[model samples]
Structures are given as C-alpha cells and as structure tokens.
Target: MSQGDERGYGGNEPAGHTDDAYSTLGGTRQTRTRLPRGGDEGDGYGRRPARNSRSLIMVVGVVVLLIAAIAFANQGGGGDTSGNGAEKATDAAGAGPTAATGTKPVQGRNGTIASGFAHDEQGAQSAAANYAVALGSAEMFDKTQRDGILDAVIAPASVEKFRTTLDKAYSIGFFRNVGLNDDGTAPAGFTFVSRTTPIGTKTTRASADQTTVEVWCSGLIGLAGEGSTKPVTDGWFTITMELQWVDGDWKALTHSQKDGPAPVGGDNRASSADEIAGAVNGFGGFTYAR
Candidate 1:
C-alpha cells in the first residue's frame, strides 16, 4: 500500500471478521450455525443478533480500539510514521549555517538600521541580510526614508543609481495596487505592512575588501484593515548583494532579488485584520544579523 493510504485492522475492508472465517470449524469438517428468523426481524437473511450486555461490551471494545488506532496513526505511527519525516523536515527548513563561533550578530547601527558590520565573510553576510530588510521595508515607500536607507546601505558609487531604480519601482500604480495612497501612505483606517525577514545568509564569494552574499528571506506586504481588497500575504525570495568593504563598513555595490528557497507553510490560523494591525503596530522590526 502507498504510504498515504489509510490503514486499519483489515486491508480495504470493514473492521470486522470476514464471512470466510466461519467457513470451517475443525480439520476437514465444516459447520454452520443458524439462527431462526422472526417473520419481520430479518433483512432478507437470518434474524439479526439481539442486543445484549456481552454484545455491547464487544462493540465498545472495538470502538475503543479503532479510536486508539486512529489517534496513533494521525500522530504519525504505523506505516505512516512521520517522526523521522518531521526531523528531516526540520533539518531541511534551516537555510544557512547552523554552528555558532561566538560571533556577534551585529557590530553597530546607522540610525535605526544596522551598520558597522565586521569586515569579514560573516560580517559581509550579516550586512547583506540586514540591508535586504531595510530595502524591503515600508520605509522604502517614502522618498526621504528610502534615500536615507540607500545612503546608509548602498556603496557611495552606487547610491544614485539604486535610488533612481527603486523610485521607479515604487510608482504610484504600485502603491495603489498594494492599497497604499499615491504618496505611499496607508488609507485612513488601514495599516500598510511591508516587511522582510531574512531566514539565513551565505557568503558566496569573499575577499579582503569585497564579498557577495545570498540572503534567503520571507516577506509580508499589503494592507490590514476591514474590507481591504489586498490583505497582507507572505512570500519567499532570495537576494544577492555584492558588497565592498569601504570606510570601515560593508556597503552594497549592487543587489538583485529572485524567488524562493521557501519552506512548506504551517497550519497556523490566519489572524483577523484587527489583530494583524494591532500586532504590526505593537511590535517593532529588528536589525537582523547572521
């Protein structure tokens, strides 16, 4: 049987003894037990067994066994074991390095964003991951905030180009599509949500003064409000950033994004708009590091 197939005491049959089990009673001898039928008691066969205390006990026993079996199976027992499967899944879910060498997650911050990362491979990876968050944040919607982020994270030589490209990307139509105003503000009763959470980071190439890092991330965007057509949703993507260690810090020379190293979604219930809005407002974002 396939692993996904449901298994019971019987193979694709009802959970009871088969008719053939009564075909013979002794070696080379066959016997049949018959019960007389009341004219109206039978349903086109011998009269059905009358209900009794012993029969009731047997019925209860079968029901209890079935219930226990089903519970065990659902918990990944029997041929459908998921204990190992779950462990494998957990291992697969982790994206980047697992061991820690006592390195600090961040060296310092530039205003609200992280800055002054260590000038090593781990530092470059950390810088890239944190930069991805800053670039993908709701702050990127406004011109001034976006410029500030670009100045802090992008290499000085690449700042102007990055700003111009991002300005075009966050156009009026894009804002409207995400339920934000042309000016990138949320509607009167709505809260705009644009957040990027980096899952892990890898230093693809590294040198004394330059490095390339890949950051696997999941993001949430849209509006949270009553009757909002565009509800906040999550998506996974990866960002590649080439960094230059300049002026005692790593800065982005160029960056690009592509889709997924996404993990399977969980069964958590979707929160309501009010709850989502409240949560977003109550909690603040972090300056992440590897």
Candidate 2:
C-alpha cells in the first residue's frame, strides 16, 4: 500500500491521527495501534484523530528514552571537563548525525519542562518536545507568560501573527469563563495544572538548517480544585513544528496542532485532588527524545 494509504484518516476520524491519517496518506506502518473499525474512532486524519492507541506509543517511546540515555550517560558519574567546578554536560542524544561535529551542547530546562537546544535533529526533537510542553502548559492560559513563551520559542516572523490571535484566546473573559480569576490566577486551595507529556518525536522532513518534526504528545488539561465542576481531563494531540537552526540553537518557525491520534484510555481509578497535587509536586517532567 502507498504510505498515504496506511496513514489516511478519512471516515469519521479526527485530525492528526498520525498512524491512521499518516499511514493512509503515506503507507508507512506508523500507527502502533489498531483503530475501531469505523465511526469517529476511525475518522481518518482530518479533524479529531483517534485516541485509543497512545499507550502503545508510550511503550515504544520508553525504548527510545533508554537508547537516548545510554548514548549520553557518562561512565563514572561525571567529571569536571569545563575547567570550572561543573562537569561538562554531554551532548544531546541523536544529534551527531545532523550537527557539525563538536558543536557545543545546548541548554534545556524550564519550569518543570525542558528548553534551550543544540543544533541538530536531536536538538530539534528536544526543542519540539519542550515546545509541546510549553504550548500545552497552564502558562498558555495566562497572557503575559504566554506572550513571553511565544517570543522566546516562536519563529520571529510568526510570533506577531500567533500572538495577536493568542491574545484573544487567553483574554480576561476567557479565564473568567473557565473559572479562573480575572488575572488568570487560580482560586485559593486550588492548584491549576496543564501539562503535555511527549510520547515520541520523528523527523518527517529535514535539512541541514531546517527540520519538520512531529511529536506525539499526550496531554492533561483541566482545572484542579476542591468543589470544581470541571476536574482534570486528558487529551491527545500531535504537534508539527518547523524549526530553523538559528543563532546557536533550533527555534520554532511554525507550529500547528491537531487533536486525536489518541487511543482509548485505560480504566485507572481517578485520584483525589490532594493526591493529584502531591503527584504533581513529587514528580517532575523530562527532556524527551526519539
């Protein structure tokens, strides 16, 4: 079959069902899970993608995560190589193939997410992963922080454009409408959390200085608070990013997302508000690869 055929999402399928939509379109065996025969579950790849296969991707990504770690893990913990007290950080995994040899490593880490970047596919993937985190973060619900993120990661040309639109998306009325304070603050005794965890990333297209990356991200978006009507909820979205090897790192040129490409969620018991809050504070996010 043509790769496109393998990835096509035509029937009742939603948008961005990479495996179904993409496989039908490109005939690549990209999808890891089987879709429901027809109806919205197999809507193809136009609007909302399928959500019943994400766990499969997570399983696959765990392998990549291990490989990436081995490629960079040091032998004896880590020794100081920077002449200063700090140990020189290792290069990002999966970067040598695209980067000029010996290019310095890129920095990464944001408030619970990863940021900064090196100059190759690994770096690009890292950037894409983190950008997905930032884009899906609760910060996006705040105007000032959202603008700062746009300015920091967005391609220079597209920043102004997306910003104008996002301004309306995160407006005061929008926040109030969502049960947030007019200033985008959470009410007392409540912890607002919005996070996207990347399952995997691939380079659909690439150039020495540019790359088109696709990230399969499973995200949780909802309000967390006692007495809240809308509790924490989850969704799956795929983010496609166009990145340029800029000044010293990869910067997003354009990014768009579509929903679905999801799988049916397992029947795990929902945790209480306090339990969720404790988990959020105890665990941290990771710098993704694959």
Candidate 3:
C-alpha cells in the first residue's frame, strides 16, 4: 500500500470533484480526474512532529490534481532511473526494481528545479525525482511559479508555512475550478496541459539526514484548445517524499499520493486538439534526477 506518491495531478488541479488528495488525512482516492478532497501532498511520517502544524503539507500540491499542468509552455516531465531504464520504464514489465542506472543528471539548479543532490541514496533519489517534478508542475498554478516552487523545493523550516497553505490552495475556487484564470493563466486560445513522468524510485528511508523517496509517477492534466472542456488526460500515481538534506539540496519535508502502478490503456487514438497542442509545444522538460 506504500509504493507512495509519484505522478498524477493530478494528485494537481482541483475543482468540483477532484480526488486523490494524496492518500490519507481525509483522503478519498480517485488519484485525479478532477481532484480536491484535500491536497498539499500527504504523508509526512508519524503525521506530525510540528511540521508547521501540517496545513495541507504543500496544499494544492498533490499539484492540485493537475493544476492543469501548470503550463510553463506545456513541457514534458520526466525523471527516475535504476537499470536498463528500469526495464524500459516497466513496459517489458519484468526486471525493474527501479530502472535506468546510467545516472547522469544533477549538475545543479534550483530556480527551475533540480539541484545539487548526491549526498547518498542516489542523492535522495534525485531529490525525490526533482521534487516530483516541482510537485506535479504547471508551476503549482502560478502565484509567481508558486512562490518560486516554495523557494526551490520547500523545507526551509517549512517555507513560510508552505506559502500560507499554498496560498489558500490556489484559490478563486482553485482558479475557476481548474480551468485557470485570475492569474493562473490559460484562457485565450488555451493550451495548458500539466505533466509529471518519473516511473521508478525507491528508498523508504535513507541517511545523511533523511529520506523516504517513492516516485513511480505518470501525470498529464487537461485543456488543449478547441472549446476546451478539460480534454487532456493521463494518470497513474505514487509520490511519497520526505527528503531533508536542506541548505544544499533535497528539500521537501513531505509529499504523498497514491493510486496505481498503472498499465492498461490502449487504443492509441486520441491525439487532437491541435495534436495535443503540438506535442505540448514541441516538448522540452527534463531536470529531474535519480
């Protein structure tokens, strides 16, 4: 039951009936279809050791069940590695206990996510796979890229209380029920489509400071164009993070989610809306590590 949070927001944008609010703490599971039973990401361990009184941990971060892919020009999301790319990222579906162990990434950044890692346990599983792609991206629905990604992956003594409970869970009724606006963007000629990739990672507790790491994601939210009505979709979940190593790398004190190891959705014929907004604007996302 604890493969733990990964990719699904989707685990992001909430509105009317969004579930998968990161597993427990008033969780209902649905893993994302709309979102919002409550989010900020779940599981911080033992519930609370006064982690800023845990107000929705990262709030709306369980990415607000897709924050509708918090459009940084709709880029692709990806991270995680073990060996043989984790058996082709679980497709061959056999020899994967966390694939792809070429281990390259991690030069260092922070402003745009990925930062210096390697302090062990594969650098806290590459800082929990790029902090679960900036906690299920689409920049957590704005507010200045969600306060610069909670000051680059939270945990500076719980960054201003997770920016005041994710600025009230990205309010304005979560940007008009996940359609976005009121500064969350995506209105004219819409294109927004959130993304989170990962697919492998596992630690369940490491050293050097702290670690939990459990990625296994696969997210992509809605809104392409053509009279948009929340079109885009792709989900699978698991995201339990609890990293530490602060002031140098690996942040996030918590972040939980769940739903699937997911695999079984074929028919392969659903790309439209301007070819899914031209493959999410000619794809270009990758900073996450392993």
Candidate 4:
C-alpha cells in the first residue's frame, strides 16, 4: 500500500448530533476517502499530472515576476521616488534567513498548557497556537481537566464566563454521539481520540498589550476500537485568538474558529482500529512554537 493510503482515520458525526463539542465548534468534516490500497493514486499525483503541472507553472511564473520586480527596483536608475522606501524594500528583499531570535519559546506552563510567552509578536502567535491545541484535545471533555485548561489559557477575568460557556457546550448528547459516555469516557475495549495539530500561525494585529492571531490547524477526532460506529477522522480549521498581555504572560481574551485553509487530501492507506489506538497512546503531543 502507498504511504498516503495508510495516513488518516476518521468518521462523520452521527445523525441528529449537535455541534456542541469543541471539535465541532467552528468546523465541519468534509467527505474523504478512507484508506485506500495504493499511494499517490488517490492524491492526484500518479495519473493526474496535468492540473498539478499547470499549478506548478503558475507558481513559477509568479516567482519569476517577483524576481524581475526586485531586480528592477535594485537598478536604482530612474522613477525612484522617496529613495528611502526603495532602500528599505531592497534591504528586506536582500535579507536572508538569520540565527534564532534567542527567545525561549515558553517560560512556564499553566498545567499542561505552555504559558509565559514573551511580550512580542512571535510570542503571541506561539501562545495562541498552543492554546488552540489544548482546547481541542480530549482533555477538554473531562470537567476537571477542562476547567484547568480554561483557567490556564483564559484571562482571569474571563475564566468564569468561559468555563460556564464550555460546560454547556460539551453536553451528554455530544459525548454519546462521539462514542463516549456521558462522562466522556470511552466504552470498555475502545479508545476515544480528539487531538488538534497546528499547521502554522499568522498575526493579523499586534500591539504592546494585545495581539490577534490566527492558527491554521488540522485535527483528528472520533473513536477508535472494534465495532465502533464512528471512527477517528481528520479535519482542517483556523482558530482566531485575541490575546491580552497580562502579568508578564499572554492569555486569551476571546477566541473564534472557522473552517480551514485545508489542503488536498493525500493517498495514504488508512490504518486499522488497533493501529490508530496504539499510535495515539504511544505518541505524545507537542508544545508548539512559531
């Protein structure tokens, strides 16, 4: 089997299911093929090269135009108004990758969530991405852990409101629909999965005391076990977090999510239920950084 055929595992939300669970807060699953037998074939890479070829050509064309523009700007002969702008642009264009900024990714943690980000753009982005992961994890299904997450990630003043709101969101019906018990525990002999992985982050606004960041993410959510009606599945989404710099750290003022800047699915084969469960148990999540 190809690598793509063995990659993702997921199932759709059950009928009549409410979108109160954190995983369904701002995104909906799109139909995707289960693990297939061959690689690259399902990913539009093996036999369908014409469309991708055209895309590649377009990308190359854009790059050539950008290079030409930069070169023309560098000529510095005529039509150069406000030489300072051109000089700045030239410096930016010429600048190459540099050494690390020397900032520690996280100074501490609020429970399992990373905290104490530096008061800067990179730090804010990092904080937002990490917080998104925490909020989207299986831990949020449990009351105690969920409260801890809220307290750890939310601003102190907003903690109570956020807690109350989430409490109502993860209802009993929501748990049952995902193959979990009312208390959010999987049935005997089964493993429930909910995990979010951030692909990247972008800062839309930043200031001394507040910053807004959007985290593009992909996630796995559902149940993995024998005879499970809902299997673990994948989704793509973007979460927008408004953060406030407080007490030498960043905390969430508010957050909202939207459906993805998702990529085309690959042709990986789907793993078995046991394989999905084992991998989830074996691998640990990460503390994201920008």
Candidate 5:
C-alpha cells in the first residue's frame, strides 16, 4: 500500500496533513484511497496494489503540473510586459525565451533606431548590439558628433561626465598613441580608420532596468600609409557595458573593454597600402542599429 505513494503530490504533503500524512500541490489534492495492507487477505482492503499502477499515477500528475506552469507563464503571469496598449500584445508574442529570434532586426518607433527588446535575456542581447553600434562609431572621435550622441543616448545626469572624460580621451595625444598623425589626421596618400564592428552580443546578467552586456567585436585601427611604420591593422576585443533603462531607451552607465578572444588571420595576401588608402577614403560608414 505504501500510503498510496504520495509522490503524486510532488513529494509534498497535503495541507493540514502531517509531514507523513498525504500529498497535494497548488490547491488540489490527490483523491486516490490508500491501497490495502498486506494482511487479512479475505477482506478487500488487505491486498497491496500493483507497483506499476503507482508509477503511472506519478507520471501523469507530473505532466499535468508541467503543462499548467507553462500555461500560466504564457498568459503573462510570470513575466513582465511593456504596458503600452499599442504594441503590448505584439511584443508579448515576440517574447518568451527567444524574444529576439525573428529574422528581421527590430526597429525603433521613429524608424532606424533599435526597438523590440523584451524583458528577458533576449532583450539584453538586443540592447547590447545597439549600444555597441553607438559606442563604436566614428562619432565618438569628433567633439561635436560625440556631444550629440551623448545627449541623445546617455542618461542626462551622466552626460556631462561622459563628455568631459571622452573629450580628454579623443585628444590629439591619444590619437597619436594609437598611430594616428599628430593632428588626428592621416599621412599623405593615407586614410586613418578606427572602427569597431560587432560580431555578436549577449547579456551576462539582467533585471528589469539594468543589465550587463558583453559585445565581441573586431576593430580596424592604426594609420595607413606606404613606407609607413604603422599600417591599418585589425584586432578583436570584447567590450562590456553596464546599462540602465534611462528615459525611454537603454544607456550605458559604464563601459570597459579588453583585447582578444581573437583568432589568427588568414594567409591571403595583404592589400597594398594604396589600395587600402583608396578604399577607406571612398567608403563612408553606416549609422548602425541592432
């Protein structure tokens, strides 16, 4: 009889029943009567039930519990929602464990910016991708461009601080150290390009309005020239940013980066200095979005 194997109640004893009494889950109780004990065989209550039957009951109960949990979560019980009526249902459907899984990139409200990030791991990844684009742009190298970006993307209170530090960072001396000419310019017949292209992004941790995002990126930097000591070169690095939902968009509270998780370059011949210079001068960068 084994007390009718109360494991059917998720190994939990029913309320009001002692620890050894019975089993129940949620607000429901298992209704099966105790199996007969192994004695007084002439009476119907004196024989043990089959072990196979007990196993079947436990399996069925567990399956039902699993289905109910999934249903509750799907009905918006255990997850967050945007509360905006216009796109709440659409966003909720795009959510679940893989909110960012769709084929097309999510678009922001006014067009071209990033949106559709949800309240989960996928949302954090989307935010990271967009942030990477913002942080790695050529705009970060120019004072006017940098200020506009900071004002538009950073939290207002932190904007001034970011601008002050970044102004100092993009100074002429800093540019020279990274192989640029003294005036943050390239040498004759050369073009200087410092750019970070993202490979992928992810969240190491997340919560409602805060998250830590890590982006793996490959960058092109250094000065390009013929008979030059420093030629345009490529490197891979990972940038990690601590982000917070500010105003209506995600913004970085702090950002730090480190060098490769890089792989070796291929054996293909390197482009000539003139070729590299022409390509860089002819091409314009994109206003990247995730």
Candidate 6:
C-alpha cells in the first residue's frame, strides 16, 4: 500500500516503477542495479551492472587453469610411469609390481619343459608359467610323457607323489572321455588339441627357498576334425603353483587350478574342422616357454 496505493508510483512517480534488486548464491551476490542510460527506453526492471563482464572472464580463466592442472597431472605427475627423472622402484622384497626384466630366458630344458630358473621372483613366475603349460598339454594324456613331465617339473620331494597321483587321475577312461585312444593318440582323421597358453604370470609369495605363483592362461581342448563329437572349445583359467628351489631350479611342490578372468566371446564365426586341424598342425608350439 505504501508504494502502490497513492504515494510512491501513483503520486510522485509514473504508473511503472523499478525496485532495488538483490540476488545471492551461497551468501555471495550483487545488490545493485543499473539506471537507465541517457536516452534509452527501458522496461521498468533494471539490468545488472555492465562491469559484470568480469565474472565471465574470471570463470573462463578458472577453467583454463583447471585444464592446465589436469594436463600436468596426466603427464606422469600421476606417479604411474618410470620415465627419465622418475624415482626408481625398490622391489628387493619380492612384493612389487610386474614389469619386463629383459632377463635372458633359461637355456636349459628338462625334456620339453624349461628348467634352470634363477632363484628369484622372476624365476618363480617363469617356472609357474611353463609348468602350467606342461601340466595342461595333450601330452599329459599319455602316461609316458606324463611321467617324464612330472619328473621334470615337480619338486624332488613331490615328484613321486605327483607321478602316482597323476597315474590314477589319467586313467583309460580319462583318455576315452577326451576323444583319445587308449594310448592317448588322436583317433583316425582327427587331431586332439589340449593346449594352454599363459597370458601373464604373477608371484603371489616369494623367497629364496620357495615361491607361490599364479599364471593366467587361455586354453583349447577337445578334438579337431569333421563330425567330431567333441569339437575344440576355448576356456580361461588361473593356475597356482607352489614352487621350491630344488637342487638348482624352481620346481612345483604343489599345484592347483581355478577358473577365469575369462573375456566375453566375440561374434566371430567358427572355423571349419579342416581349418582348425590345419592350423594346429601347421603351428608349432614354443618349447622354451616363459
């Protein structure tokens, strides 16, 4: 009533009048408004001050500073790289992140399996990887090669134990179930494939005398031929081995396996049996695997 009825706008001012403006965000704001310019016809409502242009500049400057800070942080200020001028890592305790050591591979072999591994964390991981391959290979179905593999890869203290256990495990029934003959040979016109490919190796526990490691692997098993009941299929798994420094090399004292970090299957078409068999026969596997 004081401003609208008869005093403020009705008596002393025009029909339309402007009021003082106030605005705030988190208790910070401008409480001023602009007067009409010299001869401009403006609505009753006033505009913010022309100097408010500084707010836009301030916001843009802040954005630019934020972007620069992010770039610096990403350029190895994040402490994830080992480039020049970066601090070197100390992993003498055998509990460090995995990286390429560029150590020469073991030049010795016990049968087809690698041997003469160094008595260090790297050696432990290498032994675990190769042992997983040997233990999962198609040769393990044949008792003779199986026994030799156990002898080469198992710790001296556990060699006989593993041999006896595997003898019972790989029975004639096991061979037949895997589409192999009684002598572990592929049936006529078919190729039996049981291959394990180690993807990465990790030393879970390590010491001078013994170490435990896990190897992540991708494997293929079954038969490769036309009209085969057991077509080759792929799987992923992890193999854990407890290795001992036996005599002069790393050997498995105990071994166990568990299923995957498997990836989702791709939409690629399955190849024909002839193609699969051809690939298996044409490609020779690595003998001195790491």
Worst 10 residues of 2 by lDDT: 66-75
| Candidate 1 C-alpha error for residue 145, in Å | 0.4
Off by more than 4 A, model 2: 1-105, 108-116
Question: Against the hidden reference, what TM-scores do the models get?
Answer: 0.65, 0.61, 0.30, 0.68, 0.57, 0.65
Off by over 4 Å in 3: 1-134, 139-141, 148-152, 155-184, 188-191, 195-201, 208-214, 227-242, 245-265, 268-290
| lDDT of model 2 at position 190 | 67
2 versus 5: better lDDT goes to: 2
Per-prediction backbone clash count: 0, 43, 43, 13, 0, 0
lDDT of 5: 0.49
Assess candidate 3 and give its lDDT.
Answer: 0.59
Output the number of the TM-score-best candidate.
4
Ranking by lDDT: 4, 1, 3, 6, 2, 5
Which tens-of-lDDT digit does each residue in 117-164 have in candidate 2? Answer: 766667777788878777767777677788788767766656665676
* lDDT against the true structure, each candidate: 0.60, 0.54, 0.59, 0.61, 0.49, 0.58
Candidate no. 2 TM-score: 0.61
Q: Alpha-carbon error at 160 in model 3, in Å?
A: 13
Q: State the lDDT of candidate 6 residue by residue for 1-290, as single tens digits.
A: 11111111112211111221221111122112222222233223332222233222222222122222222222221111222233333354655445567886576888778888876768878888888888778887777888888789876767765665456545454454445666668777888887889888877655557677888888877677766656666667777777777688888777655557767556566788799999988987774334
Model 2: lDDT equals 0.54
lDDT of 4 at 256: 64
Residue pairs of candidate 6 with colliding backbone atoms: none
Error of 6 at 225 (Å): 0.7
Candidate 4 — worst ten consecutive residues by lDDT sum? 80-89
- Model 4, which residues run further than 4 Å from truth? 1-101
State the lDDT at 109 in candidate 2: 52
- TM-score-wise, the better of 1 and 3 is 1
